[model samples]
Structure formats: C-alpha cells, structure tokens
Target: MSERTKTRRTRGVLGGRSERVVLEVLGATVAELAESGYRAFRMDAVSATAAVNKTTIYRRWPGKALLVGAAVEWMRTFVHDVPLPDTGSLERDLIDAFRRRLGIKERVEGRAWARLLAEKNDPEVDSIIGAAVEERSGAWYAMVTRAVARGELPDGTDPRLLLGMLGAIVDAWNAKSPGRLKADLLEAAVRTVVAGARSGSLVRSPRRRPAPRAG
Candidate 1:
C-alpha cells in the first residue's frame, strides 16, 4: 500500500461529523451568547445560531449555562489535543506549544470565548468554568512536568505559575480590541517566561547558602 493511503487510514481514527457538529454548536452558542448579553440570550437564539432545533438543544443541554459550559470546556480542551513537539530544546518546545495555543486564541471564536469568560458571574457559570479549568490544566500540567523531568525546566519550577504565565499572554492578547495573538508574539512571550524560570532556578537555595561568607 502507498504511504499516503496508510497515513489517511491512520488519520481517520478520531471521529465523524456528529462530533464536529456538536463541537461547532457549542462554539456557536458561546459566540451568540457573547454577542448578545446573557439577559437577551435565549435558548431559541442559541438553537438558531447553532443550527439545531430547540428540541435538539434541550435534549442535549438542559439549559443555557449547561450549553455554555460545554463550549467553555471545548475551548480549553482544544489546547489539550495539541501535543507539544519533542524538539529537544526547551525554548523550541515552549514556543511551539504557546504558538499552537495562540493560533486558536486569535480566532473569532476565541474572542467570543474571552468575552464570555469576562462577563461570567453567575454561580452556575462559575462552576462550569471551574470544571473546564481543572480539566485543561491537568493536561497542560502533564506536558510541563515532562519538560521538567527532561531537565528543560528547573527541578523546583512551579508548573502552575508557569502555566499561568503562558495563559496570561494569551489572555492579554485576547484583551485587545480586534485581538490577534500572532505566533511571533507568542514566541517572544515564551522566551521571556522560560528565561525567568531558568534564572529563578539558578538562584542558590536560601537553605543551601553558606553562613555569611565568614566575614
């Protein structure tokens, strides 16, 4: 068999149109909700935007927050599938990972997600957001931990804080009007964060410091 045929067969293992439709609807609902304030956003509006019937919407999602929750989860979940390339260099891996995430955040759907996140205040919304955060963070943490294990990061490096730094760069990019988180910007931010992490790790541990240099 041809290599192309082999590759095609391997790539077809993921899923089908039904999955994409659900994810697309979830993303569309988020955009519609963001464009139209929560008070003005109704199930009918979501159903229409999602191109699914009210029955379908209700059947899949009991309510608006539930639907939005799914979309929020999907947005964060996208980052999980983008496995960082094993480039053997910390800077390259970090930059590539950030760039992969940045490309998603720069899109129209991503801006809508950012808007939804900014306006979130309801308790139900908070709960869903928390769950999404936990799910995606778990995945990213594993990737960073691997880097640390490979000595790409400091032994004592805080994965949580490092992840926060990466998240903040995208958040800031999304904060701008007509926001565009370009790859170049992502690369720069990754370089800076990696530099700081390396510098902090090189600092002599306070507990390990010699007593006053015997002055």
Candidate 2:
C-alpha cells in the first residue's frame, strides 16, 4: 500500500459519500469551536470551513448541540487512538510524547479538545469529556508501562500522576511564555520527571485523611 493509504488506514478513515460529508462537517465543527469557543461558534463558519452549504450541515446535525456532540465523539477517537512513541530512554520518550500532545493542543484539531476541557454545564459535553479523559489516560499509562518493562522506572510507578505533573509544568510555562518552546526548559522538565519517577517520587501514594479536629 502507498504511504497515504497506510496513514488513512491507521487513522481509520472510512470511504463513502455519506461518511465523507459527516467527516467534513464534523471536522469543520471542531475547527470552528476551537477558534471561537462554544458561545461564539457559528454555523456559517463551519459551513465555510467544510466548503459545504449550511443546509447540508443542518440536515445531518439538526442543530449546534448535535453537531458539537458528534465532533466531541470524533475527538475521543482521534485522541485516544494516537500511537505511542518508544525511544528506549524514558526521558526522550516523554519529551516526544509531550511535543505531540502540546503540538495538538496548539492546532485547530486539538483546540476542540482544549475548549472541551474548559466547557461547562452541558450534560452531553460533560459526559463526553469525562469518558474521554478516562480513556485517554490509558495512553499515558502505556508509556509508563513500557518504561517500567525496560527497567527505566521502578515497579508501582504511577503513570497518571507523572503525566499530571508534567502537564502542570507545561501549563505553567505556556501561561507565562505562550507558544515559545525553550528546548532547555523542556529537556530539564523531562529530566526532572524521569528522576522523580526513578526515585519513586511519582509513585501513587496512599491518600491520607486530616487528623480529626479536637473537641
């Protein structure tokens, strides 16, 4: 098979007129939501982005909620099915993982998910986000599993906790410096996380309750 065919197969993109229309509209929905957020999302913009008329979008989606819901489901698949990288060294693996995730977050496709994280109230969106987060956690866990198998990390290391810490570090840096990528800082952060994991600092510690208040 050609490289393009292999890529599409890996991504699970189906072929059909109906499928094409749905995919186009949903993709446009993601881009529109990412660019304008929920309150500001416009059907006309989605229509323009998809190059399909507004009538076609409405015919399939019926309304914005349905359209966005479908878009969220598409994202769940796209985000969850991402293949993990195994670079032998935990630090290099993590750095590559972080770059892929952050690159997606800064792109039109990933912006939909970023907005989804910030979106609130709507039961449909809330449910989708909850399920997606849990499912996506497996991706992070798989990375840690590989590292552990390779003896890069100790037994019982917690992948979710490690990923959360790394995510926090990235969020803080992005907040201060925006889109700029400082390779030194990224390398330091990955090294720090690897060190912590190796030293058992990132293990899943038991929850502790506060001491009972004195009478």
Best by TM-score: 2
lDDT of 2 by residue, 1-215 (tens): 99998988856744566678788888889888888877677999999888999988887779887888788888767675777687777888788888778778777777777787777565656765777666667767888888988878777688878888888998789768766767788889989988877876665547443232232
lDDT of each: 0.66, 0.78
Give candidate 2's error at residue 75 in angstroms: 4.5
Clashing pairs in 1: none
N/CA/C clash count, model 1: 0
lDDT per residue for candidate 1 within 64-103, as digits (tens), equals 7777767666765564445556776767866766666556
Global fold similarity of model 2 (TM-score): 0.74
Models, CA RMSD each: 7.5, 7.6
**What's the lDDT for residue 13 in model 1?**
44
lDDT at position 153, candidate 2: 78
